[model samples]
Target: MGDPIKKIELKDGTTRYRFVIDIGRDPATGKRRQLTKTYDTKKEARAEYAKVKHQTDEGMFVGPDKTTVSAWLDTWLKSTTVDVEKATAANYADALLPVRERLGGKRLQDVTEEDVDELVSWMLTSGRKRGGKVGSGLSVRSVQLTLGRFRSSLNVAMRRRLVVRNVAQYTQIPREARRKAAAMAALRVPWSETEVRQFLASIRGHRLHAPVLLALIGMRPAEVCGLRWSAVDLDAGTLSVELTRTLVEGEVEEKGPKSEKGKRKLPLPKPLHAALRAFKARQATEAIRAGELYERSGFVLVDELGVAWKTDRFRRAIHKLMEQAKVRKVRPYDARHACLTYLATSGVPDVIVSAWAGHADLSFTKRVYIHPNVEHLRQAADQLDELLG
Candidate 1:
C-alpha cells in the first residue's frame, strides 16, 4: 500500500489530509526523492496522488516550484516583448514598485483577488515622499494605470503557467472612486479665444514662439518638438507630422507618430506660416554668426544655441509667456484643447476636425475636444428661436 494519509487541523479550524509520494531518483545524485501534496479530504489526496503517479509514469510530471509573485514579475519585465514603448516600459516598472512592495512575497499560486483589492486601496490613499515631504494620494487615473500594469504582468505569468489565473483582473475600482476621477477630468476647461490670442501676442518675439504657435495649431508638444525643417513646406502652407520626439529614461528619442492618424499633413495657419518664415530667416542669421560652432539639427524649434528644445524647457517657457500675457496658466498641452474647441465651435464638420486633430474617431474629437462656450451656445439658441418663430 502507498503511504497512509495524515490529517492536520489548519489555523482556521479546517482539517486537511497530506500524503507523500516517491516521485523518482535524482539523476545527478542517484538518490530517491519524494514530493508531498495536501488536499481537503482523503479522497482528494488519493485522486491527486493517482494523477501524479500517472504523470510520473508518462514522464510528464514537473515538480512544484516555490516561485513568488516578485520573481515572476521580474522575469516578465525582462522577457516581455509586447510592443511597449521605452517611456511606457519605465512607467510599468515604476507602477510595479508598489505592487512588489505589497504582494511580492506571496507565492504566485497563492495570490488572491482580495490581495489585488488591497493593492488598489493602498494605491488610492498612499502618498510618495519627495524632497522631505509626502504628497497627497495618487489620482484615480494613476491608480488605474498602476493596476493595468500589474494586470499585464500577471497575464504574462499566466501565459508562462506560473499561475493558474490572473487574480488582479478580478479587482475593480469602486463606483465612488470612478465618479471622483470623472469629476476631476471635467474640471479641465479650455481657454477662451481671447485668452489664446493674448497668449500668442505675448510670446510673439520669444525664442519658443514657433513651437508654442504650432502647439496652438493642434500639434501635441512631442509632435511640435519633433517637427523637422524637412517636413515644413512654407510655399505649400503645410507640414507633415511623421515623427515624434519623446523623453525616454532621461534620453530624447525620435520615433514615428503614435498612430496612423498622427502621421497626416496639416495646413499651416497663416499666422504660424508667417512666424515660421521669420524664424527661418532668424535661424539662418544665427547659423552664419556661429560658423563652425553651430549644430545644424534641422528641427523647427530650437534654443538660442540651435539645439532642439526639451519638453520640460518648453513647458517652462509656456508658463513664463502665460505670466507675461496675464492669462490664466494652463498646461502647455492645453493649447490643443483651445485649438480643438475653436475648431468645433466654428461649425467645422466633425470629420474634418477629427482629421485635423489626428483623432482616430470623430466621437473622441466631439466628446473630448469640443467645449462650447456660453457665447456660442447663446448664438445657437438665437438661431433655434428664429427657426421656431
Candidate 2:
C-alpha cells in the first residue's frame, strides 16, 4: 500500500529486498528525507520498514552519527566531573591510553561484544610497546583496572545517547588472569613488630628518621610527606592527617585525604613525640645556619636546605634505610602494615585500629593488614579453653 518493496536477484540466484521510508524533513534544509534499509527477504524488509515508520510517526527516530569511540572518549573525559580526584585523575588518563590505542578508531555505535572481548584478550596476552620493544603483558590487576576505566567511559557515551549499549560490560578478565591475581594477593607479606623495631633503631639519627617514624606510626607515605608543623601539637601529643602529598604524572600535588576517615587526628606515641621535639630543635639550628637562603616551607620533614621531600626521594631514602638497617627488607608502606599487624594481634578493637590507620572500612584492614601469627592463634585457643572450663 505504501512504497512497494523492490526485489532484486543476485548473481548467486538469491533474492534481496530494499525498503525505503519517509522519515521527515531535514529541519535545517526544509527538505524531505528518507531512510533506506536492505534485507535478505521481503518479509524482513517489511518488518524493519514498519518499525522505522512507527518510530518516524512518533517523532522518536534518531539518525545514527559517525562518532568514533576515540572521539566520544575524548569528549567524555573533558566533560566528566564525577569520581575524578586530583591525585588520581592522571592514573585514570593513563588507564584510558590503551583503550584509545586499541579501539579509538571503531565507531561508537558499532562497537560489538566481540570487539570488547578481543580488547581484553589482547591486554592479557600482548603488552603495549615501550621504546622499540613490546613490554610484558599487563598484570591481571592492571588489565582489570584498565577495562574498568574503559567501561566507565563507555557508560558516559550511553548516557549521552551516543551508543545504545556499553559492550565493555559483557567482557570479563579471563579465568587464568583471575587465578593469577588471587595468587599475587595471597603473597603480600607484612613485617613483624620485631623487624619494625629493629629498622627504627637502625635508622635513628638519620635525616629520614622523622619520615620513617611517621610511617611506623601508621601514617601513609603521602601523609607523612605532606605533614606540616602546624598540624602537629606536641603539648596535646596529637597529629592531624588532613592533607596528603602525591606525585601524579611527575608533578607534586598537595590535596586532602582520599576519604572522610582519612582526615583524622591520631595520638602521637611517646617516642614519636620526643623525636619530633628533637627534630624541630635540630631544624631550627639548621634554619639559622642557612639564614635567608633557607626555604621557609612549614613542612615537618625537610632537607638541610629546608625543601620538602618528594615521593620519589622518600622512596629511595626508604630503600637505602632498609639496606642500612640490615633487617628483613620491606617497603616503607609495610611500616603501616607492621603497625596494623601489631595492633590487631595485641587485641586492639578493629574499629579503633581502622580509625587510627585512616582506613575507610574495617574489612580491608582485617583482610589485608591483620596477619594472625601462630602464637596469637594459640593464645586465642587458650582463651577459648579457659572460657569453656
Candidate 3:
C-alpha cells in the first residue's frame, strides 16, 4: 500500500510551529481512522506524530470554539451593571458604541492586543462633543473612567467563564493631575458690617425684616423663608433647621436640608434674637386684638396674609433695601458669606467655623473663607515682630 498518509508536520529548528493529523487504520474492524496531535518541535513533531499514532491506537482529540468578542460584549453590558445610575449608563454606552463597529465581526479568541490598543488610540485622538462644545478631544480622566467601567463589565464576563482573561487588565490612560490652582485665587466677598447695618435699617418698616435678619444670623435663605414659628425658640434664642422650602420646577415645596449637616440647630445671633422677639411681641398684640381675622399661617417669615415668602419677593425686598440704603449691591446670600468671612478673619478655627457654614470638611471652609490680602500681610508682619525681637 502507499506509504500510509502519515502524520504531517511543519516547524523551524527546535521550535514547533504546527500540528498535523495522521491517517491510520483499525486493524480489528479493517476500517480507517484519522488522528491528530500537537508537537514541541519538528523533531518532536515526529515524536508527536508517533504519539498521535499511539492516540489513534487509543482515542483523544479536541478543537477550539469560535465566538465573536463584540457579540459577547453586548451580552456583558446588558447582564452586568445595567442597574447603574442613568447618567453612568449613558456614559458607558457612549464609550463603547464607536468601538463596537471595529470589533463586531472578530471572534473573541481572534481579538489581539493590537486591537484594544488601536481602539484606545482612536478614542484619544478623535474629537468628542461634551458640555456645549464640539471638537474637544477626550480627556484622560474621561477615557480612564469609561475604560474602568468596561473592565468591570469584562470582569463579570470572566467570572461567568465567557472569556479566558480580561484584555483591558494591562491597559491604562494617561491621567492629568487634579489641579485646584484656580481656588488659590478665589476670594470671599461678603457684605460689610456697615452695609449689613444699612440693609437692616432700610428693611425696618417691611414685614420681611425678620426673615432678612434670620439670614443675617447665617441661616440659609431657604431656611429663613421656610422657618415655622413652632420651630423658633424665642425664649432660648435658637432656630431649628429641620425643614427648608425652595422653588422646585417653579413652585415652592418643602424639602429636606441639602445635606444632613445642614439640618443643624444654629444659635441665634443677638441681633436676630432681638428682632424675632420684637416681631413675636408685635404679632401677638396684633393677633389678640384681631382674633380670628389675624391670618396665622404658622410661618415665621410671611406676607401680609401670613403666606410663605417667595424667592423673587425676597430678592426684590433686598434690592429695594439696597436701593434705599445706597449700600453696595450684593446678593442676599452675601449674608452667609459675611458670617463665615467674619469668623475666619477674626481667627476662628476652621473646624468650628466649617460647622456653622454647613461645610462637611474644614478644608472647604478654609478655601472659601481664608483669603490672603494686605491685611493678612500686615497681621503676619506685626505678629512675627515679637518673635523676631
Alpha-carbon lDDT, every model: 0.83, 0.83, 0.67
Q: What total of clashing residue pairs does each candidate reach?
A: 0, 0, 0
Give every collision pair in model 2: none
lDDT of 1 by residue, 131-235 (tens): 133655677777788798889888876655556578988789888989988898777787899888888778888766777889998899999889999999999
Query: What stretches of model 3 exceed 4 Å from their correct place?
Result: 1-188, 201-206, 285-294, 369-373, 385-389
Could you tell me every candidate's TM-score relative to the true structure? Answer: 0.83, 0.86, 0.51
User: Residue pairs in steric clash, candidate 3?
Assistant: none
Cα lDDT tens digits, model 2, 173-217, are 888889987898667666776777788788788766777889888
RMSD values, in order shown: 5.0, 3.7, 12.0
* lDDT score of residue 279 within candidate 1: 93
Q: Which ten residues in a row have the lowest lDDT in candidate 2?
A: 127-136
Per residue, candidate 3 scores C-alpha lDDT tens digits across 55-105 of 445543212225576677677777754676443445576666545656758
Model 2, position 321: C-alpha lDDT score: 81
Lowest lDDT sum, 10 consecutive residues, model 3, at 176-185
Give the per-residue Cα lDDT of candidate 3 at 192. 65
